[model samples]
Target: MKLMVSFSRKKVSEPIIARAVMDTGVLINVERARIEPTEGDVLIDVPDESARTVCMKMRELGATVSVLRDAIIRDEDECVDCGACISVCPQEAFSFDSDWKLSLDQPRCVLCGRCIQACPHGALSLQK
Candidate 1:
């Protein structure tokens, strides 16, 4: 399960994530993060079964948690596979496989909107 964990300045100094992981015994994979001095959020992946446990632990530590499952809504038919997304993707989430087919690695995506704008066919969108 993917989660967006947000923390304020007060909570930033607290080892919230570390505590959550230790308490739940769930290894959290932090995919992306933008933590400023005042506030920030992290995109993380956890075991599906242990996601609830992690979320509860994080919330107990005063962190905001939001689940993002199948966050990317991809339209294969609308995609032309022109490599527009592949060219502009900062995380290298979009790629062309050996068969010359486009592939999307969702875990690497940080929900950046660049790919949606780069796509001429409007094949990709994020679920709110």
Candidate 2:
């Protein structure tokens, strides 16, 4: 499961994520992180089995967590595989497979909307 975790500037310096990882035994992969002096937002992936515990722990530490399952949807028919999304994706979520077919690593997506905006064919969209 993927999650978008928000933290206030006051909480940004906390070792909340480390504690959650240690407590829940969940492998947390940070997809994207934007932490400023005033606020922070992080996109992370957690194992399904440990999502509940991790989220609970995050909330207890005063972070806001939102599940991001299937956050980005791609329309194959509309996509020409032009690779527009590839260059702009900070998380490297878009890629070309062995066959040069455009592929998306959904879990790595931060729902940043860059892919959607870069797609000339309007092939990508946020799931809501």
Candidate 3:
């Protein structure tokens, strides 16, 4: 399960995420993060079975937590299998199949937005 955890100014210095990890014993894989002193957010993936527990624990620790169904959206109609997205994806989420067609592994995306920017046809976008 994927989760977006947001930290406010007061929670910035707190070891909230670490505490949640320790309390729930959930293994969190951080996929993306932009953290500074005042505020920040972290995109993480935890075991599906433990996602709920980790969400509750993170909320209890003063984090704004929300489940994420997808990090990116691809419009098949507009994409032309040009491979531009594949070239810039840091997570290697986009690929070309044996038929020379583009494919996407949505879960592998880390919300980097590189694929969207690289697409000439505006077929890819960050999930809003």
Candidate 4:
């Protein structure tokens, strides 16, 4: 329940403030200020106790486990501007470009995954 979400940059003297939460979901917007997860970051989905164990293991391995989730977000980018996604989202998580293409507001998103289903373009997933 107390998993941390850290931003790790190799060259930076200090990583930015990390986010730790006890939530069930996260945002999937790849636009501005998005904390995109990479391959080496640890993902946990078990109970809170198990998550603690995993966090300890991650720390032992010199990796920081910043947040815990029951799922990993794999978002799709096949947006063709049909505008179906923007309409269904209660949070207005998606927006449009000048060309009418779709862009995401990652910080404003809560990763509800509704955009994935609402998409006629199949532009969202929970894979990575």
Best by lDDT: 2
Better of 1 and 2 by lDDT: 2
lDDT of 2 by residue, 28-84 (tens): 988788877788888888888888988898998889999987799998899988898
Model 2 pairs in collision: none
- In model 2, what lDDT does residue 22 have? 82
Better of 1 and 4 by lDDT: 1
> Model 2 TM-score?
0.71
**TM-score top scorer:** 3
Candidate 2 residue 20 C-alpha distance from true site, Å: 1.6
Runs of candidate 3 exceeding 4 Å displacement:
11-13
Q: Can you write out model 4's per-residue Cα lDDT over 1-128, one digit (the tens) per residue?
A: 43443334442223222222222223221222334443222222335556565455445444555653433243445656677778777768677889887676654454556777877766666444
Compose the digit string of candidate 3's lDDT tens values, residues 1-128.
88999988785456777778888888888889998878888999999999989988888778899888766888989989999988798888888999999988877877888888889999987777
Please give, for residues 22-83, the per-residue lDDT of candidate 1 as tens digits. 78888998888888878888988898899888888888888899998667778989987788
Count clashing residue pairs in model 4. 8
Q: Model 3 scores what on Cα lDDT?
A: 0.85
How close to the true structure is residue 109 of candidate 3, measured as C-alpha lDDT? 78
Query: What local distance difference test score does each model get?
Result: 0.85, 0.86, 0.85, 0.49
State the lDDT at 1 in candidate 2.
88
Looking at model 2, how many pairs of residues clash? Answer: 0
